[model samples]
Target: MPKLTFAADLQWRRRFARAAEGLALRFALEDARDLRDEPDGADDPDHVPLPVHRDDYDFDACTDMFFQDTDVLMLYNARFDGIEDPGGETNQQIGMGDLCTAAWFDPFGNVKTRDPHRGFRR
Candidate 1:
């Protein structure tokens, strides 16, 4: 498991948290977007604890904070364009282009990145 990073959009966090909670997994969440957007003492009255706010921290901090015991699931786009269904070759249609989804990552560096602060590129 290599240390890989996946950037998940903020909207999906709640649903993910609920699902993980139900599955008896202790998941942690940091708002990366927030971290990116807000830098140098930018605090909202209703500031949520997100990655944007905590840019100083790295990947390990996120993993330790959220994915301590459970697997880390990051959301990403499933760009399966132009891939036709095998059984339905006659029907020509592109696959679902983009959507909020999750991917499981191992705890070790092999699964995810050891450097939490690194920007995710996908």
Candidate 2:
């Protein structure tokens, strides 16, 4: 199954956090409206997710994270950094509107420079 639980989030987030810390990259995390049933977000920080794909379009619109208030620090997908929904309609919604905010920075902490750090784009 696709990993979507808190355990998975911890693994991925910590990996990214470590690398960011190593580079001395500075950033702050905003509050998140997490979906997982937890006591609170402060005690359990929410992690940014890459492009998500939900196979079952018929049952749930699966725009599960659309309203999530947390701003993403960075989002790197191997290719086409876009969310995928089987039906195609939901993808359009996310693309056209409410695309989650992502904060990308270089080693010096410049956000979205024209040089495009590591050739990654917004």
Candidate 3:
């Protein structure tokens, strides 16, 4: 796993900030382990702590702080967009096109064939 530098983190924050326009949602670059476990326990046996300049001990509690009573929550698995599995024989990985295809539907299962590149060209 590659560690994110401070510069990279700031860059990503800016990108997300731009993308989150009119969404009224707060963005955070949270660690995977912090989201998975409490402070006192080991989240996973294979977990290896990555070095980050800052630590947010209350990240889990603060994640939903911006949500209101009327807000509808929709979480997308962005990791699926570019994760490669080394254990697979073919070294399977998901592409941006695949993610776009998978998410080209409304909550009611209505297909929307809009090109993803029109908005975000990742």
Candidate 4:
């Protein structure tokens, strides 16, 4: 596994500091196993499909739905055993709810606002 160099760490810190302005920070843990095994709400009546562009939809649409109002900073624990394959592919999975929940709760206590003219208020 590779480690973040001092310069890289400093650069990330500077970028994070800048982005943190008027925003809250949150930390959540989701094991790759759990994500991989999560049910797709096939039998759940309350399940609502994520929004996507009507014409062309794909993984990017799912990502857009997930990070609608919030920015994501992913930190992978590649040093952990059994998480990566020889091809360097990871078993991690990210879904729309994760981003929505992060934005819903201002974990760092930053105020949230939404445009009144818009239908939804966050």
What is the clash count for each candidate, in the order shown? 20, 0, 0, 0
> What order do candidates take by TM-score, descending?
1, 4, 3, 2
How does candidate 4 fare on TM-score? 0.22
lDDT of 4 by residue, 1-122 (tens): 11222234544444434444423312211232233346853333453454434533243443445444432332234353333222333423322132222232334335464433343212
Residue-level lDDT tens digits of model 1 in 1-122: 11122345554444444334423422223354345366643475454464564455464565556443321122121333212232333223323222224333223444544453443333
The lDDT values for all models are 0.37, 0.32, 0.35, 0.35
Candidate number with the higher TM-score (1 or 3)? 1
Best by lDDT: 1
**Estimated TM-score for each candidate:** 0.23, 0.20, 0.20, 0.22
Q: How much does candidate 3 score in TM-score?
A: 0.20
Q: Which stretches of candidate 1 lie over 4 Å from their true place?
A: 1-18, 22-36, 39-41, 46-60, 68-75, 79-122
Q: Candidate 1 — what's its lDDT?
A: 0.37
Candidate 2 per-residue C-alpha lDDT over 37-101 given as tens digits, one digit per residue, 9 for 90 to 100? 34653244343333445542221222332322222212233232433232346546545333332
How much is 57 displaced in model 2, in angstroms?
40
How far residue 107's Cα lies from its native spot in candidate 3, in Å, is 18
Which runs of model 4 end up more than 4 angstroms from their true locations? 1-7, 21-87, 91-122
Of models 3 and 4, which has the larger TM-score? 4
